[model samples]
Target: MDYIDRAEATRRILAAKERAGLSFEELAQVVGAHEVWVASALLGQNTMSSEQAAAAGKALALDEATVAALSRDAARGSLPAAVPTDPLIYRFHEIVQVYGTTLKAVIEEKFGSGIMSAIDFSMDIDRVDDPRGDRVKVTLNGKFLPYRTW
Candidate 1:
């Protein structure tokens, strides 16, 4: 298995993280990035600089090769299948299926012929206690890029 498979390196890092008993927050502090970003990078959803990778490796006690793998540019959005089979991931797919058009329409109306950028985005997740149950509060902040005319 290779890093390109998106499992080998990640698995090693996860093992080290477990052994260290370090939370994502603590690891993020060492990596000098936001927790969500650090998590995403580790999950192969984003790329990390050499320094960031070295820091992460040092903090996680990963091998140099794994650290080098972490620094490589990833082929992003490589899913196992077209539609995910995982229940939680499937729910997100369902959300997009049900509301994707609605979201596009509303975003166009508000942002004006523009689209939100995942490249230049920030996300935050929080836990909110509710009378019914604990709620997951997620905030996605993205820069809006308007369509350009020739």
Candidate 2:
């Protein structure tokens, strides 16, 4: 089947999602994947399996072209600018800018010269009840890959 571009596919999926009034979590349940992974696949940052694509298509009532697009390998990293313009995204960038070194130092101290593997990562977002206020909790879990030496 001829597939549409990832951006167009994303647009179509988003439109269908809005029409269906489905949250990413709901769609993820239908797709049998984590919400973040499903969302990333729908947004063109990651590829979905054929089964997942079909499930997501059914959930969102998406077209064949969009469904096919979802299974294609993605180019990844769609940030349009060096600094993100979106407030929420920018805040994440800000956090990295501020705490990147600290995190690196801590991680290195704990795990030696290694880096977390985004390729083998899973993330979860949840709400934590707090007396002061409800807090957004994001957990990122990834395998640690120590740098190889010649």
RMSD value for candidate 1: 2.4
Model 2 worst lDDT run, 10 consecutive residues: 73-82
Model 1 lDDT tens row, 71-121: 777757746768899898898889989999999999999989988998889
TM-score of each: 0.90, 0.95
Identify the leading candidate in terms of TM-score: 2
Q: All candidates' lDDT scores?
A: 0.86, 0.92
lDDT of 2: 0.92
Q: Mind giving the per-residue lDDT tens digits that candidate 2 earns over 47-135?
A: 99999999999888887999999999896888976799899999999999999999999999999999999999999999999999999
Q: Which portions of model 1 show Cα errors greater than 4 Å? A: 1-6
